[model samples]
Target: MGVTRERAIERLAGRHPGRRGFGGSADPAEAAAFRHAMRGDHDLNPGVTPPSTALTPAAVLVPLIDHRDGMSVLLTQRTAHLTAHAGQISFPGGRVEDADPDDVAAALRETEEEVGLPRDRVSVIGRLDTYITGTGFEIAPIVGIVDPPVPISIDPFEVAEAFEVPLSFILDRRNHQRIEREVGAHNRAYFVLPYEGRNIWGATAGILVNLAEVLAD
Candidate 1:
């Protein structure tokens, strides 16, 4: 069998030596190989960080729903009126508040505040490397396994809609696209995974690419 839900959970539960910055490969591999490969090697996001900006700290929950249909990822579409990342597909998270104890606390708290996913319902497995955004935020993506059928009440002020994407679709490297854009005087490349009608790209897509590398098979 390929990577089973149980096996994926088990792998995620293991301790990973935390890296300073975010990085991962998009190449598909068997789960056993992928797990080992993630321990010491991955590709870092290139040329996205601006030289003059100070990066703010942020955290996000990479929520994996353990459903009977199949493993899926929960995502959110931000409201169009927001000032930052408006109308974009993203995880339920934001900049870490001073009251937050750590990255895990920030992730779970934001998940609850943004999407009504109670912290108690989430089973945090581990965290991915820190992703430094061009806009100047160093984000920690926390991987969590969630129980199915839990009620979600998304905050209308921040989230326009909430939806799930099949893990199988995202785990496939072929779905990841390398896209580029010119910001001011610089051109930068980033990852994009367009699903159905939603365009999942930038930091969200980069984190998904890291997840695919961590769990690919």
Candidate 2:
């Protein structure tokens, strides 16, 4: 019907390496659309080199869990007191540490730390796209399949609650809203996926949009 667990796994497994297995990979139509959309107007061309400005390396696990009907994406809401992204809806992840081998490792490690979803419980399939946020972080969205019934132990300091949204709901283009909003001194177009009264926007919503594009029939 719509975005079943088996179909999602089959789809992600088919993404051939674009750049080192994640960057610019163009399988399942095309990848890294974020590279163009996320860039400043001055850096519009695909060939334009990235600016020298620093973007902290970060990774997020886009966890998909199975259900009798279809798959649902696992997400988290940050605690209100956190210094950054407080009380926002997000995936289970954080900044990539130097000790980590790569983005995948960083994503899994962060997922484990933030939500207590052990690394072994997740079966990584592929990646969505590398998204660089306005906050100066280069994010790698690692797509993975998590078996259901796994215990969740959240770190209260970083996470307020863990929840899931049906993948079908996310993949449906009808729900993806692009709004022009004024920020500081500039107006910017951003994606927002509103679910069950929760405002899912920014990079987290962007990553979900990419997944929807990749898995669309």
Candidate 3:
């Protein structure tokens, strides 16, 4: 790809604020209202996060791997036995633990723990908007560049397998679709990115869209 790591960083820096959401959101605690709003709003399947609701803070690393041919994003398939989002595609990350210093630190730490990708091998360039899920998670999507690819060693309990999707493909909004599903007697619509026959949906898909918009030319 013609977009170099430096160029990606420059593009991210172009944003007025590093991230956005309710109350300039990124922290779900700042979540203002909970309504059935998903018409023009980019976020679909958003759940009720009343201002008083204390959402669990989480972070995920949107790892952009640098290859000679181009850039690709590293994603993971959660182990089928896991509780939430079992067997679904996701970026490497988890809840922000008390031991972690901040969102970035938690993202890097969780990444290393989940996929054995070293913290030192990645350079965090920027972030996408904070995303809230129907399951009550306030996710901080931290964008990072990974150079000098490392052999992935996945945790069997947390990840089933690790894979990559070309960044260019994800950047093309055309590759995404708005699909509706019935959840608890209600219809909820969300974006889905199909890659190699696998469907990347929900928050993972939303974050990918966020990345595409943030790095748009």
Candidate 4:
């Protein structure tokens, strides 16, 4: 939290845009575009100081597992020893590399490297707005539908564990909570998705909110 904390704005989850079928359709193509794009709300978290600092471009894959009952979002818990975002739940991704062709490639590559989820197993459908983090990262979130029954291996160095949270649970406004705290001279406010005992907050929560808005539209 920083000087830019604002009241929590939870977008209501409703009918899915472009949904041709009824009852929780997991159509990746239908869930592509959002009515309005996200701007990495400054009031949510004023990222680095001097706003002029060079930002590292990154990408993450929002893996929607196509389960029989419904879809679930695949997320990972970073190892506590990591320098950045230690012990936090996050999407499998990292800073975009020069060898990466685009955001999609970066996301898929990072996901494979971090969680061993093959690109072939992922049906990349669309992308969400780029989210800028307080740590000076420009993150592009790529939404992909993953076919289940695939064995996922985790990178012990970076990822501590991998788990799936139901998409329905995440989209519901009743589950999203706004938490605030005083950081130095600023009052910081951010979204939190507390599932079971897991605390999903910060940029991760922000990205989920963006996804919820897109699906709700």
Q: Write the per-residue lDDT of candidate 4 for residues 170-203, one digit (tens) a residue.
A: 8798888988888899778889999999999988
Lowest-lDDT window of 10 residues in candidate 3?
33-42
Ranking under lDDT, best-scoring first?
2, 3, 1, 4
TM-score of each: 0.82, 0.84, 0.85, 0.79
Listed per model in order, the count of residue pairs whose N, CA or C atoms clash below 3 Å is 2, 1, 1, 3
Q: Give the alpha carbon lDDT tens digit for every residue of 3-48 in model 2.
A: 7767887888866423332324445223344344442321322334
**How well does candidate 1 score on lDDT at residue 76?**
96
Model 1: per-residue lDDT, tens digit, 118-166? 9999988888756666555667789888988966999999999999999
lDDT (tens digit, per residue) of candidate 3 on 1-217: 4567878999876443323234334554334433112111335535633233455778999999999888899999999999888999999999999899888999999999999999999888877777776666668888899985666888999999999999899988899899987768877788999999899988899889878877778
In order, the Cα lDDT scores of the candidates are: 0.77, 0.79, 0.79, 0.73
Residue 88, candidate 3: Cα error in Å is 0.5
Residue 177 CA displacement from its true place in model 2, Å: 0.9
Name the candidate that leads on TM-score: 3
Task: Give the local distance difference test score of model 1.
Answer: 0.77
Candidate 4 lands at a TM-score of: 0.79
**Which scores higher on TM-score, 2 or 3?**
3
